[model samples]
Target chain A: MSTTKKAHTTPPYELIYWPTIPGRGEFIRLVFEATGTPYTDIANETKDGISAVLALKDETATTSGDGNPPAFAPPALKIPGQGKDGKALVIYQTPSILAYLGNKLNFAGTDEAEKHYILSHTLTALDLNNETHDTHHPIASQLYYEDQKPEALRKATDFRESRLPKFFGFFERVLKGNEEGGGKFLVGGKLSYADTTLWHVLDGLKFAFPKELAAREKEFPALFGSFYGSVKEVSGLKEYLASDRRLQYSQGVFRYYPELDRQ
Target chain B: MSTTKKAHTTPPYELIYWPTIPGRGEFIRLVFEATGTPYTDIANETKDGISAVLALKDETATTSGDGNPPAFAPPALKIPGQGKDGKALVIYQTPSILAYLGNKLNFAGTDEAEKHYILSHTLTALDLNNETHDTHHPIASQLYYEDQKPEALRKATDFRESRLPKFFGFFERVLKGNEEGGGKFLVGGKLSYADTTLWHVLDGLKFAFPKELAAREKEFPALFGSFYGSVKEVSGLKEYLASDRRLQYSQGVFRYYPELDRQ
Candidate 1:
């Protein structure tokens, strides 16, 4: 058991999330890929690996074992030999995982203040990510898109006209304010998880609403022109994004419905 | 400036948020009150302190100054002498602020694993809080509830019948799994921001959907019977919750709209 973990820094850092669609899992996966950190994407890599993801939020299970409480949702990270008694430490929630990994992987900034700013920005990006999900499923996540078409249309329209501009304008200001970032980073000069997290949401947005994004792309020059383009070219991200490891967007947090786009 | 800050820890921890109504600001307030930490609620206390809150997300401004980037929203924390070159460090996002204060306030769990669990659970509780807000405004936040009444009814129905049960069950199992927690704490043997955060959301749910929460309260005994009731009696929370400092819910995240509540 110890031997397997030693090959990758003595801890098998495993990602447990739904198979396929990038969803929130991509936010966690991006950090590991960008830092060249070795990890296992349980659902995508192994047969029946999705059981691990299911178990994290199993309604009947009181705990996910190893003295860990049951997770409320997935995109949980399992690190062997990291728990209270060298057991696997499992943590769920995208932003929490990103903060933990970001700090450890050096993507969180140098100082304490920068670390939090990175988290603050990462959370805002995730908030936009969640709003994108709500664009198609405004009424309920369990219900089909057809059942909530009218609500989705109204929600998506408001999202495009009002919410997008509000979020985009705020992020643009963040990019423009940081003189050291040169319009690329949201926080300090170097790359942070906040950058990767925001970049993925933008990527998902482009896939989910190309027409709307294209029409509004030029509105926020710093966000679209520099910050969006620059993150893709970052060392490990450049390669992982091009690889098969980067899954396509479909039926997850982001979905491409022509009607939901800028018609 | 130094003299004023010196009285409260040499770095006046100021909470910049809208005056009146708890909204998301209550979550930040609970931590300060829980830990007996000295801080200022800028908008509620000071004359025209709301200008500082307004300036946080100023649409025309590129930055919030003192080297901080433009905040995406309010509930921002301003700490003097905590930024680069003693220029004041400001950060926004509810969970981010909670995580920072949770760690410092001794409300977050002791170890690395417990800390993340507390944060993960806090995020989930905040998710529920956000969902409660959506029950009253499903189509769009900017639109009045009357304009979106039809959709809010549908969303509120799903929230009561489905969403509430799922969240409640998850927290119940978390309390059951931790023997040391004894049904009161969500993580370790002590109370966490996760507990307080979840308590507030439940309190809001009671105010917002009295019938729904009342009918479903007994379904999760450990959560409602123990955890929910236990937190309010805790040291700081007991005193804080009983005082006028504990604001009532009105036109905020947990608004009491009988139409949106269960029949």
Candidate 2:
């Protein structure tokens, strides 16, 4: 396949996220990587990047103008304008950003039904992501994980026993039902943004709850092995995952709190 | 405006949700109400509705076939087929369902950017909804509100003091920045599904945290009053709210736990 020059020719898309953790930004990064889209990860690039990321949340910031609404949180994207007078559009909300990218990148599905299907899966992945994050911060996001450890243990148990199996089973069903794709991709036969999202969800689960996920691995052979294997084999994604850019899982959304994990 | 015959003329949409609480189903309900779309809240109608709702989660169920995937949770919509051979499309995820309804009901936006803007706002509303839900169930959804009351109190404090104000401010900014609608609606000048969602959010907040919300009511004049007032004035919605069909809020996503609330 010939490489698309759009990444090089067009102004680089700017992503504003926290400097340390991969967090929700990883989902967007996966999309950009899978599609071979060239973009600048702003917070990782400069010493003042965190300040720039926080400024978008500042109501008094200059970037808040030019008909743009202030982003509620990070992982905000700044896509270059089409014309001279057109200013960059800044939008937040992870699912919304992914949908915007999916539309622009043609990874969102082909028809309306397919698009909604992809969306449903993406939102489900996000739900799983939020639940995983809460496993570590069950009380409050502002509170220290140490302070909330007891509640986190309780929350993590329900998450692993109930939520994980439920979500994984749902994805497996989606993969199996995709007759158009022959059970390969999440949506149409072709790989879309939802596949990348599921891949991340599976990856995060494995990282956070290694023994528990491993125990259930045989339960979702298609989701854990085949579907996940396919996403990992995506040429560009394979390379990106191996690169230094793939931030290690730490105190981010999917933290490996050993006390919270179970067999 | 003439009442669109789409409600009665078309096959009624079947909504599969919990029979009791409004929960996330209310968001979808508001869309149908605003557009005058006829839908059967299945769980509320038949004695076997709860069984039917749970059957969707059963992997071995026959209805899971015929090209429909199992729903991850309730508030799943089963739209009647368009053609003789067409199968009823089953979709879940509140945002996705709302998007599907917005497209059919003409509440989504006129252009691509407008559609995305609406989506971004809707997702943010959902975030607020989730946070609000978490205030009552800070530890685990599986646990009763009473079981988590202490942690719930702590979580509710951060939510009311920090998260609620932040989200309300974001909505106000979105309303203020909408040049197309002149701040009358969330996206365009005319009422959309998102406007209904924002109205519900404000209403739920008031119901759950009356004192705190009332104290901050003047802080978000556009969101709390003007925009909300306009949404209430929407002819169809006005009638729907007055009708018994509008489920009273209790022990749902937004609940009135007096001990959890503060000024």
Q: Best DockQ goes to which candidate? A: 1
Estimate, for each residue in B1-263, the C-alpha lDDT of model 2 and write its tens digit: 22477845766788888887778888888888887777788888778888868877786532344476667777788877831148778888999998888877888977665676677888888889889999988877888988988889888998888888788887887777776666578876678777888788888989999989888889988787778778888878898888777888877888888887884
RMSD vs true structure, all candidates? 2.7, 2.9
TM-score of structure candidate 2: 0.92
Per-model TM-score on C-alpha atoms? 0.97, 0.92
CA lDDT, candidate 1, residue B213: 88
What is the DockQ for all candidates, taken in turn? 0.86, 0.49
Error of 1 at A113 (Å): 0.9
DockQ of candidate 1, scored on C-alphas against the true complex (2 decimals): 0.86
Candidate 1 lDDT over A1-263, as tens digits, reads: 11333355635689999999898899999988778778889999999998888777679998888888888888888888888898888889999999989877788988998999999999999999999999999999999999999999999999999999999998988888888999988888899999999999998999999999999999999999999999999987898888898998889998999999999
Error of 1 at B239 (Å): 1.5
For candidate 1 chain A, which ten residues in a row score worst on lDDT?
A1-10
